[model samples]
Target: MKLLFIGSRLYDDIDWYVKRKNIESILTESNENAINLDLPDQVFIVPRGMDGPKQVAVMQNVDAIVPLIGIDPPLIDVAHMKEEIEQEHGIPVIAANVRAVELTSNKIKTKKFYDEIGVVTPEYQILDSPDDLTLEFPVVLKQGEGQGGKDIKIAKSMDDVEEYFKNFNQALCEQFIEGSEISIEVLGFNGEFVALPPIYKGETTLEGTHPLSKVKTGPCMVQGLDNNLVQHTAYKVAKNLDSDGIFEMDFMYSPEKDQLYAIEVNTRPNGTRYLTTATCGVNSLCELVNMAIGEFSPANISDKLEYHYSTEIPVGDYNGPCPNEPVKSFDDNDFVVHGPEGYQRLTARADSKKDLDNLISKLL
Candidate 1:
């Protein structure tokens, strides 16, 4: 089987899996300097949008297309391309459709979607100005579109709201819920979706600290929250979207209120994949390759599930050894180190919590 994968930034993460599947890889990148350009069987330096990729997919006559875009801006374009390619031709393109991207790409739209779908989300009001704010202080001020905590502020006062408005005229103000921040990856393809184990991303702070800077653990042991509830809710949301590929959903469980609030949905590969792969033996990136090859299903995911205690921590600069293989799977090693210099993170796993602690100590 041949696959045309758009974007080379994340190719390295799944190159081993693609090669192992005996799938011929053709990649398109915006620049020649992108990483893992040489890993693909063939690479084409196309322009930055999905237009070039769609054209290349046809010209190459690839069997399928799997977009590896990690950012939000180009998802709409990719959705359009996916729609056209799959409709004009019979080739499968593993990605979210236009409606899914439209609903998820914007924070305000996502909140409305959650409400319409009967999924609980934080109370929100669109603020054209600071004077229009009614969500109360300690609310989360955010733009309609951003990721990784970008343009997000915990407003403690009117001054903070005014301070935030200097750059943007509008905001998606939401009531800040102080509780356990959780993330889950639900893989969907051909109308079947499977929500993996929940990951605990730590408690929220008044400073609006993102999970990126916090230590996170998998198979969430939060006392009042049940993993089944999380997985069921995530599955519902994915089915509502009715899209293919991966959906990385962010949620918060407030023990005080005994509520689980949906925060965001990213219909692509995300930061949560590393810990998800460690906790459960399923790798989302590798699964995308499987989706293109017609191998993704609920039964297949069930067959791959392996329970383990896993945790990811920010080391800033990891002076530790690397994995036995280039892949991120923990089959050969207890730990996998990722990220760039001065911002590296280590994800370690073990059979038990005690073993996990000991493995972490040894890795550190």
Candidate 2:
């Protein structure tokens, strides 16, 4: 068997590294050949970035084609274009259909889907303009195409909402649940089967090693939150949406209300998905391949895995920490003590806030 991974250059794509690692793992387990092709980067599905004929040529000879397109919302349409091309060429493209991707990509649409399925999610509304509207204060305003928390803002007043609306073409307003945020990574095979593990992120230094700004950057550290209620909810959502491959679903659990509300769904191996490999030892990528190849046997899957929660203080901003020092303590708000290990810069999306807080408090 032969597999072709359509993605960008390895150095530029950390997620691609995870993909490469899984390819190696699958190869180790089976007698198959695999090759990774770095598709050129370009705006949209322009002809210059990828040669459709060339892809068709490769697909004709490969047993499977897995496109590693970025998880940006706009790119949903672009991936659909590639799917069309691949299917027309008689190659089995293992991808969530454009409809499925679109539903998850657009935050507004995702909210509607969740509501229709009787799944609880934060109450939200869409704004096509910065015009006047009646919404509760302290609402969460987010751009439709936002990932991580980059375009996410907590609007405290109507004036704040209007100002944020002026900053973007479209925005979403949702009731803010004051609670801990959790990212659930799910893997579905053939759009009919699914598995999920809860990845918990507390807080981290604003600066230092966090990679929230980059695509597919894993959090500093993560522990599996063995909450079956959360895990089951994630699995149900992925399946109801016909999600296949690797995807991430974010939720904010309100301890005050003891409620969990779905935030949004990412259709690709996003920064949060990196937890399965980088932090936890789930190895979701390897499972993706096994499922893709009809290896969904009972013994091939695991119902439980080791999980951990950090007892370290999460450094949100390490601006003052010594360049090569381990995080010892945050002192005078200028710098933290550095140890022989230097600074342990857990990249943004790296570790949880509590994890950093615990670590820092201990050192201090």
lDDT of each: 0.91, 0.54
Model 2 alpha-carbon drift over 4 Å, by segment: 9-60, 73-90, 128-131, 203-226, 278-280, 296-299, 308-364
Who wins the lDDT comparison?
Answer: 1
For every model shown, what is its TM-score relative to the native structure? 0.98, 0.67
Model 2 — TM-score against the truth? Answer: 0.67
Per-residue accuracy of model 1 over 10-75 as CA lDDT, tens digit each? 888888888888999999999998788889999999888888888888998999999998899999
Clash number for each model: 0, 35
lDDT of candidate model 1 versus the reference: 0.91
lDDT of 2 by residue, 1-364 (tens): 4454444322123334334434321111011121222322211221323354235435346555555554464356445654776667655555666877888877888999999998999877787765644567667778666665677777777777777766787788788776556777777765555555565555322231233422222232223333677778888888787756767788767766777788888877665443444434445544544554566432344543434332222344444324222121111111222111333233221245566455444444
TM-score of 1: 0.98
